[model samples]
Target: MTGQVSVAGLGPGHEAQITPEVSAALAGATDVLGYIPYVARIAPRPGLVLHASDNREELGRARAALDLAAQGRRVVIVSSGDPGVFAMASALFEAVEATGRTDIDIRILPGITAMLAAAARAGAPLGHDFCAINLSDNLKPAALVEHRLRHAARGDFAMAFYNPRSASRPDGFGRALQILREECGPGRLVVFARAVSTPEERLAITTLAEARPEMADMRTVVLVGNSHTRRVGGWVYAPRSATVSAPASDPEGDA
Candidate 1:
């Protein structure tokens, strides 16, 4: 049958926040492929085959899911956040596209992204227009990250940063801060969310200048505010965009 396959979001850090539909899809799945840490977040659902892999073998893990799907197994490829949002969905599609095989049906059941989870936990700081950028240079050049950061500042759009820092890419976090500072100013609101939905979760609301590299990790996501986003009542908030109401036209008279 080449069963319906999916890259499921496990929610940011815990099993409780997993959506019922996603959980059901996973429960029905014959196999699941993901990094070891995210795989550990799932409870032992019987009859499910786990293909846990080391974090570094992203492509390998994704290929495992594709292989399982090709085998007519209801396979679920899990990700920490929404699979499409800086996660596994793209990689899966890319892999299939490279192989020139789109015969397998793939579905993406969305889940709570880390940025959204963190934003809601604090406040609606992303109420306005926003963009998310991955700071990791492993896939893209650091210069490209800097260029995007510069434009985001000039456009005055709120931004969420994914993969803010890691041991291999130690300079991404600091460099992002530097570009934002150069484009904006020192007082802009920046929130650092770590281990969202997990026991070790930490959320810090501070300015760009005050964000320290020591607290950031691969799980960390940084939200850098536009000029409008403000910190009040221990929360970060962005005001709604202004919209001018159009003058109502008389239905019959205008005609």
Candidate 2:
């Protein structure tokens, strides 16, 4: 039997949100590796081996899975959301490149990401042009994050944020709110969707002026509307059509 590696997503939180393709992959996996929380989602079986590691061990985990596959094990690497969207798929590819293992058979299975799930729950805040940004500075610099935030805001694009805040870096999201308020103004809509599709799920809609940093945490996915986003009845949405004057080009050479 040929060794294979399947990097699969398990969806946001609910089992129902997981795609049939990913579930099927999990069922046939001889070995599974992932973050501790994600690996816990898989059921134990007679021939299956589960490897759970800390969240910071992504690169190591990816290499381990590849090694297992090289040994002819049907390995599956699981992530909470879409593997391609801020998850294991990228890490797996990076490991493949570092190890010079181009011959490995790898499959990237997609699932509903937290951003899209939150958008659906909020009545389509991302109905128009949008961009998703991860605010954590663990892998990238903070200056780059603010630069992207300003550009995205200036372009009148709706925005989705993942890993918005944590205890150690609580001040970052507060600074982000300040930047958004300056670029998009006080009246723009902001949605805070936490733990979507789960029992503890929460959805809050407010204007940028009223938004506070304390409203968000690690589990929360923050959404900012373009200038055209508005509320219809009890739901918030960004209209399909928008009419806005073009923003001025950056003075620092960025267009």
Evaluated with lDDT, which candidate comes out highest?
2
Q: Flag regions of model 1 displaced more than 4 Å.
A: 242-255
**Model 2 lDDT tens row, 1-255:** 458999998999999999999999998999999999899999999999999999989999999988999899999999988999888999999999999988889999999999999999999899999999999999999999999999899888999999999988989999999999888889999999999999999999999999999999999999999988999987999888998645544444573
lDDT per residue as tens, model 1, 1-255: 676679899889777788998988877888888889888776676898888888767777777777787888888888988999988898888888777668988899899999999898779889898989988888888889988887677667789989898888887788778878877788989888988888889998888778777668988888888788887798899888633222232224465
Against the unseen true structure, what C-alpha lDDT does each candidate score? 0.82, 0.92
Model 1 misses residue 12 by how many Å? 0.6
- What TM-score would every model get versus the actual structure? 0.91, 0.96
lDDT of 2: 0.92
The alpha-carbon deviation from the true structure for residue 159 of candidate 1, after best TM-score superposition, in angstroms, is 0.9
Off by over 4 Å in 2: 246-255
